[model samples]
Target: MTSTRTRLTPEQRRGQLLDLGVRLLATRPLDELSIDVLAEEAGISRGLLYHYFGNKHAFHEAVVRHAADDLIAQTAPPASGPPLERLLTSVTAYVDYVIANREGYLSLVRAAAGGNDRLREIYEEARAVLTDRVFREDPEGHILLDTPAARLLVRGWSALTEELVLTWADDPAGVTREELLDLIAGSLPAVAALAR
Candidate 1:
């Protein structure tokens, strides 16, 4: 690959690399990402790429971490809102993000299910962060989700939401976004009741 040097500082260059990796994840599953291709896309040498990231696994880990941070930041709800409204806001943001970045979101799911331990950890961490945020504001303490039962319910709901969002993204004819949202929102009480 041809290399054209840029004047970006080390940290800026690393951030640029991470950004490119994120874009690449949008089109390819994590396991399929090619280091050579990444280096080429960045217009940098493989040696230079390794200088920034020790190896492909390191690169993947950085990308996963970056994606998780973005996912959480983009979907964060207003802290002052009513509990249900905040949850709806968060869920809506999540569904919107998945719809807008289907390939990337699916890549995360595929990585988690494909036995990539690091990716699985990052994915679960992201999910747990969101689940905790959404349930922490429960007015009736129905969805506080601190107990084992509540935690399990939240995890199940998260899985269900991911499946529904992916399915709807793949083929809207099966279910509209609003319908999917309704189903997700409707399940909250039942899930919360499991805690009680």
Candidate 2:
């Protein structure tokens, strides 16, 4: 009997490793992820993993970056819709995503708070991307995040949304998903208005 494997380009192989890392991350904390374990999971050697990511910290950074990007991509708002409708749709998608990836989401948050500077940078960058999208997609000219104060308030709203969704996912506390979504989606304008 002969064993054979399909050959993949370096890019494809790296992407495959990152995808695997993200999947594993969904179920475990980042600190628990080891290069040796990941290499074994991929049927590769640890040296090969090093070739792709350089070192353990680099590998973790790459994995976190991929996860953050995936989260942002997953919750992207529809390209066409009423402004409020799009906001609600985006918020719904975000909530659904966090709920589905609850453990992974928590791990990411913990990793950031655990004093890993690179992970913290990746996490903050992800939040900034989401915040900028909200401003860029404001078709109604309502969320005028023009001034620094306005932008600060909108960022605060983003933080609130994240905290609310994470807490609400653990226990709804009698708040239906729809109501939670409404509160998150509807409050942005008011939150932004505070800077007026």
Q: Cα RMSDs of all predictions?
A: 3.8, 2.1
> Which predicted model would earn the best lDDT?
2
Off by over 4 Å in 2: 1-5, 138-141
The candidate maximizing TM-score is: 2
Lowest lDDT 10-mer window, candidate 2?
137-146
Q: What is the C-alpha lDDT of each candidate?
A: 0.82, 0.87
Error of model 1, residue 183, in angstroms: 1.8
TM-score of 2: 0.91
lDDT for predicted candidate 2 compared with the true structure: 0.87
Candidate 2 per-residue lDDT, tens place, 1-196, comes to 9999899999999999999999888878788888988999999999999999999999999999999999999989888777677788888989988887777788888887888888998999998888777677544644565678877887899889999999999899999999999899889888866787
Model 1: weakest 10-residue lDDT segment is 134-143
Clashing pairs in 2: none
